[model samples]
Structure formats: C-alpha cells, structure tokens
Target chain A: MKISEIARLVDANIYCKGNEDTDIRCAFACDMMSDVLAYVKNQAILVTGLVNPQVIRTAEMMDIPCVIIVRGKEPTPLMLEIAADRGITVMNTKLRMYSVCGILYNHGLPADEGE
Target chain B: MGALHLEYTVAPDDFSRAGEVSGIVKRTLKDLGFPPAVVRRTAIAMYEAEINMVIHANGGKITADITPEEIMIVFADQGPGIPDIDLAMQEGWSTASEDIRDMGFGAGMGLPNIQKSTDYMDVQTTVGVGTTITIKIFVTQ
Candidate 1:
C-alpha cells in the first residue's frame, strides 16, 4: 500500500507529502528509538508514539519514507520542518500505539521484514 | 574509483543537530546507486554511531570511506571513554540520562545497534581520554 493509503486508513493527518505513491511494505512500531534503530529492516513506514527530532532522524537514517505518530502526539515545528525537508511523510493519529499496530496488521501490513 | 571520502564534525551538546552526517551520507550513497539494503544498513549503523557521539561524547568526528566493495566509517570522540566495553556492548545497558531516554534514545542499545546493523564493528576507548569506533559494511555484488 502507499503512504497516502495508510494515512487515510488510520485517519492520520499528514504533515508532509513524501512519496505519497511510494510503496509501503512492513511497518515497525516502537517508542524506544534504539530498539527502532536496532530492528528496522527496510520498513518504509514507522509507527511511533515518540514525538521528537530523533524520531525524524531515525526515520531518515532508516530511509523510511513515512512516519505515523500514534496517540495523537503533536510533533514540534522543527520536527515537521525536518521531515518536510527530507521528503519524508509525517502523520498523526488518535489511535494508541497498540491499536494502531494492530489495525495495520489486520489490514495485512506485515511487521518488520514480514516475519 | 577511489572510495569517496566524507567527513563531518558532530558538535558536542547539540542534541538537535545529531544525525546530520548520517543524513548526508545516506543521501550520497543513494545517489551513487548503492543497493537499497546496503544503503539502509550503512545509514542505520552510521546514524546510530553519530547519535552516540553527540549524546555520550559531547560530539565527535565521523569519517566515511565509500568504496564499491564496501563502506568504512570511523567515529572518533574526545570524551569520557567507555570504562567497560563488554558491559557497554550489552543490548540494554545505556548510561544516557533520563532526558535522552524521553527523547526516544539512551536505551543502552547504541553500540549494540551499530554492531548489529553493520557487517563489522570495532571499538577502542580510553577512559577520560576518548573513544574511537570503526565500522565496516560491505556491498556484495
């Protein structure tokens, strides 16, 4: 599925327009940035409740095209700006982390290398 | 072709500017047409190392040598060095402050993550003097 589709599916508000058409495969969900860093495997979409610049940095480092901030956490202006500059899509959803991950999984979105 | 060399200085105490080097390096590697997996791994490893430099060592310099066969990244910092590398290498042993943890890091996984995401990792440190890390990730044909 494309990032735009994920945004709509989760009722997320996209803060950036990164590759809306980019194909998204598995999703990695974590608030622990290091864990996210340790386990991310070509997952294009990152679902996190953490709202911070490092979140953007992690997504950028992993070449993740999109980030969906769960739990309705608002990202700082700097974070949004950075994501926009990097051409990475950012979105916020009311769904808590577990429900967010579960919904995506139920929709056939694999988790981390699809294992 | 000689490996494309890149270098960056990570300023100490600058949490906001962390990962700048890794971001640029990632872009350069992608633009060079490296395999996506190779590019991703290199970016992740280097980025984690970069963050570690800023958060732990107050800042450092990163040198990356990108070759067709492999990419080598060396991170050197002049700060309180690791006292016990073995303990530091553990997956969940981090000394980062509570503030850092709130920002989503400091989970004692920086070194481990760098090690796991890279093909090879080497660490050299001297307490109160500094520490240096060398990581290599190969791009197989």
Candidate 2:
C-alpha cells in the first residue's frame, strides 16, 4: 500500500512527508520500542501512541520508514526534527492505536512476522 | 579498504540525542556500500547498546571499527554495573523504572535484541564499577 493511501484511510496528518509515494510492505503497532526492535523484521510502518524521540530512534535503527502516532498524541519537536533528518515520515491521527491498526490491516497491510 | 574507526560520547539520560551515533554509523555503512541487511543489523545492535548506556549507566563511550569484512562496536560505561548477567539477559527481567517505560523502552529486551542482531556479543561488567559490551557483525560480500 502506498503511504499516502494509508494516511488517507486513517485520516492522518502527515507532519514529515518523507516519500509519501513510497509503498508500505507491512505494519507494526506497539507502544514499546523494545518490542518493535525485537519483533520487526522488514521495513514497515510503525503505529504507536508513544511520543518520544526514542520512537524515531527505534524506527531509524529498524529501518522503519514511517511512524503513525495514534490517540491524538503529538510527537515532540525533537522527534519531528529527527524524523525529518532521518527522512522517516511522521504522521498523527485522532483515532486510537487499535483503530488505526485495524484500518490499515483491513486495507491489506500485513503485519510484520518476526524472524 | 582500510578500517575506519569512529568514537562517540553518550550523555547520561539524554533521551533526545540517544540515537545520533547509530544514525551516523548507519549512514557511514551505507556510504561504504554495505548491504542493507548488514547496515541495519549493525545499527540496531549498536543503537540498543547506546540506549542502555544512557538509561542504565550515566552515559558512556561508543567506539566502532568498521572494515570491509565486519563491523565491531564497543560500549563502555562507568555506571552501576550489572550484578547478574544471567538475570539481566532474560527477556522479561528489566530494572528500568516506570519513567523509562513511559518513553517506550525498559522492556528488558535490550540485551537479547542486541544478541539477535549481531553475529557475536560479549558482556564485561563489575557491580558498582561499570560495564562494557562488545558486539560484532560480519559483512558478507
């Protein structure tokens, strides 16, 4: 699925549009950075409610291309700056994490099965 | 190609600047034409160690020796060292406080994740003194 389509489906406001046309292969939703690092195996879109710089850091480490902040939580300015610097797209939605994940899953975005 | 050595200083509990080193290393690996898998593995392993230094120790020093064959990284910190390596290595045993958990880490998966990401890992520690973790990932051409 293209990143823009996912954003449209979730009604997300993309703060840092890093390759909006890029295709998303899978999605992983979690508030725990460690779980994302331990479980995510491919380049995927990260859906979470966590609003910290570590979220961006974890995505950079895991090569996650996009992060969707759910529950209307806004990312810190530092997080947005880092996301922009890393060329990782950052978005936010008023919907909760579960709803965002469900919407994306319903749109045919698969979950990342860890290796 | 000659080996490239890089060093970074991690500020204690500085959550905002935690992943800078890993980002630089990742960019360097990409510039050097390493495979994506190799670069990601090296980045993830080193990033976890860097976070550990900031969270557990009061920050530390990170050194990376990158060559065409492999990348070796060492994280040395002078904080309260791990008392039990076995217990600390467990997946669900974490000593991080709730504040750390609110930041989306502290799940006790740091060491195990590092182990899984790297080809080799070594831990050296002394309680109340410090800890040093060394990890290496080979670049397959």
For each candidate, give its TM-score against the true structure.
0.93, 0.98
lDDT of each residue in B1-141, candidate 2, tens digit only:
799999999999788888889889999999899999999889888888888898899999999999899899999999999999999999988999999999888999999989989999999999999999999998873
Could you tell me how far off, in angstroms, the CA of residue A23 lies in candidate 2 after the best superposition?
0.9
Among residues 3 or more apart in sequence or in different chains, the pairs in candidate 2 whose N, CA or C atoms overlap within 3 Å are: none
> Judged by DockQ cut-offs, is candidate 2 incorrect, acceptable, medium or high?
high
Model 1 TM-score relative to the real fold: 0.93
Best by lDDT: 2
lDDT of 1 by residue, B1-141 (tens): 667988889999888889888989998999999998888888888888888898889899999999999999999999899999999999889899999998888888888888877889999999999999999998883
Which residues of candidate 2, in runs, are more than 4 Å off? Answer: none
Q: For model 1, how does the per-residue alpha-carbon lDDT over A1-115 read when each residue is reduced to its tens digit?
A: 8787788789999877887778888899888888888777665589998888889988888778899998888988989889999988989999998988888899988888633
Query: Candidate 1: which stretches are off by over 4 Å?
Result: A113-115
lDDT of 2 by residue, A1-115 (tens): 9888988999999999788778898999999998998899989899999998989989988888899999998888998999998899999999998899888888899899875
Candidate 1 at residue A5, lDDT?
76
Candidate 2 Cα deviation (angstroms), residue A110: 1.3
TM-score of chain A of each: 0.94, 0.97
